[model samples]
Target: MKTNRGGGDEALKFSSFFFMPERPRDYLVLFIRFSVIACLVVSVSLVLRATFLSSSPRDYSTTYGLRFTTVPQKSIALSPTGSIGPLNVSHILFCIAGAAETWIDRSQYTSLWWRNSTTRGFVWLDKPVNLPQNHSDVRFSIPIRVSDPGWTRFKFSSSRAAVRIARIIWDSYRLNLPDVRWFVMGDDDTVFFTENLVKVLSKYDHEQMWYIGGNSESVEQDVMHAYDMAFGGGGFAISHPLAARLANAMDGCLQRYFYFYGSDQRIAACVSEIGVPFTEERGFHQLDIKGDPYVYLSAHPLTPLVSLHHLVYLDPMFPNKNPIESLQNLMKPYSLDQNRILQQINCHEGKRQWSISISWGYSIQIYSYFLTAKELTTPLQTFKTWRSSSDGPFVFNTRSLPPDPCQRPVTYFMDGAEDVRFYGTKTRYSVADKNFGLCENNTEHSELTKVKRILVTSMKMDPEYWNKAPRRQCCEVMEGGRGKRKENEMLIRIRKCKSSERI
Candidate 1:
């Protein structure tokens, strides 16, 4: 009875307050305040819901029974205080896989292109090696970093080195280097044409995930491995964001893919788990061949020459020189015009009834007889497969050398190159002193043999040329070519073809 009276009193007070009439102005103000409060509560609830949904993990399942769990995108930590304007030699970090045993011989290949203070990265070695007292040479440009020891703990099939090498991507990312957009991995013997490499990499957005490189040239090797796998010796680039993701997952991935034969395959497998596919840039030459690389290097694809590998297995690029010497000779012209190195251009000298093929910065061939464009472009079958020395099944087409020596063209190797004015270059090619039977009865053959040296003039190829759809530049025999010049000399010019000009 006492509790009922107290409850009744409270109810009566609430009812009186609810029913009490107020001024019209006061009522309007009350309604407005109520509405505003309601709106604020609803707005706050909506904002909290949106934030939670965005930050939380979500599952997207398809009708086909496949499910994908996606998390929020994480922002990458860039060490550069200022904005990275454009990709350059410094923007790339090279993580070279090296061993103490072979470093002495193979280190020369790395030195060939590695710039002392400009290029970034380290030669990751199994163990440290003694250095020469005179370490001032460009050959010692790259500093060495010995890998952490626990790489042997991972289960491996063929070689334990695969585990250590595959972990390079992980170890390199852990360094937390500054302003590194791309991490380029390669074998110690791999030689990179860095200028051309920078040109190719600039085309891609480094902020996004990119795994760019080339596959094996041999179909057998591709079949033995994976067609989509980037051959490591050719060198491959992993963008910053992708490298971070790979590094986080590399230890677990290495444990899972331990049975893979090669380190490249292990890397490919880990990359696949991250859902980034292998992107092929044809300029990366794995050089998966036996015998000679002359014909292959001569007829380069319509792209920038980025890298070359497996030089130790193949014959020297130029005759009468060792492998390193040949590369040094090639590098001289490469330094002059890297974009135009080994770029092919063929033209017909209609008056002399001759066909001329130019592998710029490398070699040139002059034919007394006329040959079709297809015949000139196709690489001669001068190489075999990597694993098996078989003739069939290369990635690209090849043509056999003509059985008749008479049909063969006289060959010339690059002697020297000099800048001609500001915009152009003049590369000289001296006839190689090799004995071959000439087309004896033909007048064109006799006249061509007397021509000893050929001078090629062309505008310096802009590095920006590779950014567009590649079209081979057309060439023409200069006017008064054989008439006004010395009997032992020839001149030619390479230029862009006009809209109506046909090859």
Candidate 2:
């Protein structure tokens, strides 16, 4: 064995290279040192694994595949599909600003949109009212909750109600209703298109601070109440986090802004202190104007129509109908296609030199002569400023009616809309008023004059369309794909524009 120990001798030499401890206890010492090293390695591995997990953010995606990153505790905006889900009407808590005196008249307006079970929140009245025992009989969809009497203590130069109204935000936040994401405040007369509102809000993260609303249509009003202020009548939305922060600072904020003229102004001032800026959404119409809203509505912005306020001060939405009745008619088509309601589309037939503009679910304008896409989209100045009744500055561009009525487009108001099942929908528009004069019996005008009704066919717009950048839909006159005359009727189809197509 000693004679043939070639590899064995090398192994022994390698083992003895570290001066061998001669005691048996030395082996135990060596084993303890290796064990300690093993334990430290295992401990380090576990610490690393935990640190990676704790520092890494959880990812959340929306129905549209929008991704948001958040940490463990403050992952507020993440959909609870596993924890929360996409924003729905139930997540929105509407805090309606109302008064006991106006409740009788304004309750009618609230009943129009408010759903008893489907919608959440209450009509916060200045004082408790003698509400009917059987709420269903009265057709009121929202229950009344009297605002805390504590609002009267705030100092204010404006109507004392402004102070109370401003507190609606704090009041709604303090309720601590579970699962609420947004607090929407509006006047009793404000009509909200809740479906479209949900669509708009779905784009924003509810956990983050958002002060969303619209400025007054009248420059005078905006100048008086900071152009950025979200007029309460037009309605505004505050995200859950922002509302909570607002609640904490609100009482002191109210005292500071007591001299403000409007409840909305006071709110804007407080929100400014929190370092949140006003986010103006075109869809929320303060409607700070007097007279017919027809012109303004006819040329709505290329966005979802969210809310309308001051209906009591203006003429009804349609001719030959009162305000409520007109609203009832409008809601008919709105129920059918909410996103398409008041959406404007223009098409021209070259053969007849005819230009047609369609306000889906609202009105139609037809002209024998040609008008550029830009001109047709601009609303006519048929309305005056809210305060002065002057016909000057508006937030958007407006074209004055021609002194000659002949230059104006023949207008048609929506009559009805019907769903076409598997296909789409058909909206009918008929002449409402014969107020505008026709051009002196020209042959081109003759052909247009004979047409009495317009039938619009369109697919129900997906609510997700609002989540992206807005583009006006393109339209084509049916039959010849140009304006073809029918016996007192015209048919048109609306659809998304081709990639290479122009409006």
Candidate 3:
């Protein structure tokens, strides 16, 4: 009975050992598993927090709206050359009226308005002043001028003008109850294309970029060359921060320098000093006496933005004759009176024998062509083909003179072989016979032979054939085989010769 009881107790002890954990090792294993799971959960939480929850904040105070305004000098008298005689007032009035119309049209897209002060008998003030209400984003600020006679000098004029415009711009910002992103300074004669300007500005939203009117070129100090900086009086735009900087800069300058070259140069110098760079756009161009004026026009067909100091009036009589007149004639189709406008500007009665000189590239040979036709005629019928020596010149076999007395004399030289190389002597033509000398003692003959040899070699004829080939035949061969192997071989030989000579 004792042995059987002992066996049952042993069996019970063995079963308990199998079912329960009795060692420290087992507890340590369980603790390590729970610790690893807890560590993984903590690491995942930290990663999510860093990636999705904790990010740098964004700025919300930056301005987005843009405003445009014109700054006209009312206190200062017009330049001596600015006079249009009896039509001075009429011209100024017409410019103001045209500007007003453009402003009204542009106001549809953004805030467009005139920024000027009251002056004595200024025709610009006489125009209808109605600010558009539809553009909630746009507003106008026409500040009253506080006349100060002492502020009439070049430096003072620019500084004071900047201050006044800046104040008006700031006031507009306050009244409109919105943050203004950009402020554009333009001329009264400028016709703004608000849509295009807006499209261009949208590209550089956060970047503080200045869009200067006209082409900007680096000029030397001593040279009295045409100003290449952004003409503030013509058209230019400044970012919100830049506008503030400019205003502050101007104010600082007003307290110091009393002599500078007006507002445009002053602004240019000031901005340059501050290390603020400008981005140029063709949207703003100076109305000039050269180039295609219509290409510079912001509002196509009729109105051009920012007619500089020169192109204030359109000459009616010589509409297509001169720069200003040509611009007027080009805009005639869009003007109110087609024929009467020209007559009003004295287009029909003018008999002035104006000298017209046509320039061919960088050459000095100015071909003078006169027109006896009625003034304002485009003279499309009298058009002359532009010839260049590099472009293989104009070939005129017949020695017929042009109808106009002012036309330059073009003497046609012929090669009896009918393989003549026609060149325009117009560029290098000398009016003085003394400048040209006849071939003396066969010096030109040697040169002619050398040129002929070069021509034969360039034509890539066999060495034997080139030695005996006629000049006309060589020329004929070259003309026929333009893009052939002969042309390439000739080019290669020329390059090799030049390189060898250099070496």
User: Which sections of candidate 3 miss by over 4 Å?
Assistant: 1-163, 166-182, 198-211, 215-226, 239-241, 257-262, 277-283, 288-312, 315-503
Candidate ranking (TM-score, best to worst): 2, 1, 3
Report residue 6 deviation for candidate 1 (angstroms).
53
| C-alpha lDDT of candidate 1 relative to the true structure | 0.85
Error in Å for residue 421 of model 3? 48
| Candidate 2 accuracy as TM-score | 0.82
- lDDT (Cα, tens digit) per residue for candidate 1, span 128-162: 89877777876665789999886878998888998
**C-alpha lDDT of all candidate models, in order:** 0.85, 0.84, 0.32
TM-score of decoy 1: 0.82
Query: Taking the candidates one at a time, how many backbone clashes does each contain?
Result: 0, 5, 4
TM-score of each: 0.82, 0.82, 0.34
Error of 2 at 211 (Å): 0.3
**lDDT string, candidate 2, 26-127, tens digits:** 788768767897999999999999999989865533333333333233222323222267889988999999988889789888888988778898888888
User: By summed lDDT, which 10 consecutive residues of candidate 1 come out lowest?
Assistant: 61-70
Instruction: Evaluate residue 187 in candidate 1 and report its C-alpha lDDT on the 0 to 100 scale.
Output: 95
Tens-place lDDT per residue, model 3, 1-503, is: 88999999898876654444578786776677668979999999999988875475433332222222223333211111111112111111111211344444432212222223311111122125566574344224332222223333424533445433323322222222223455555544543434234434544442354635553211221122234466543466665555545554554555454445344555566677677765665445443322222211211111122323223332221212553343433232212212111111001111222221111111011112233322211212111222111211111111222344334321111111111134211111112111112333443222221211112111122223212421211011122335443422111011112222211
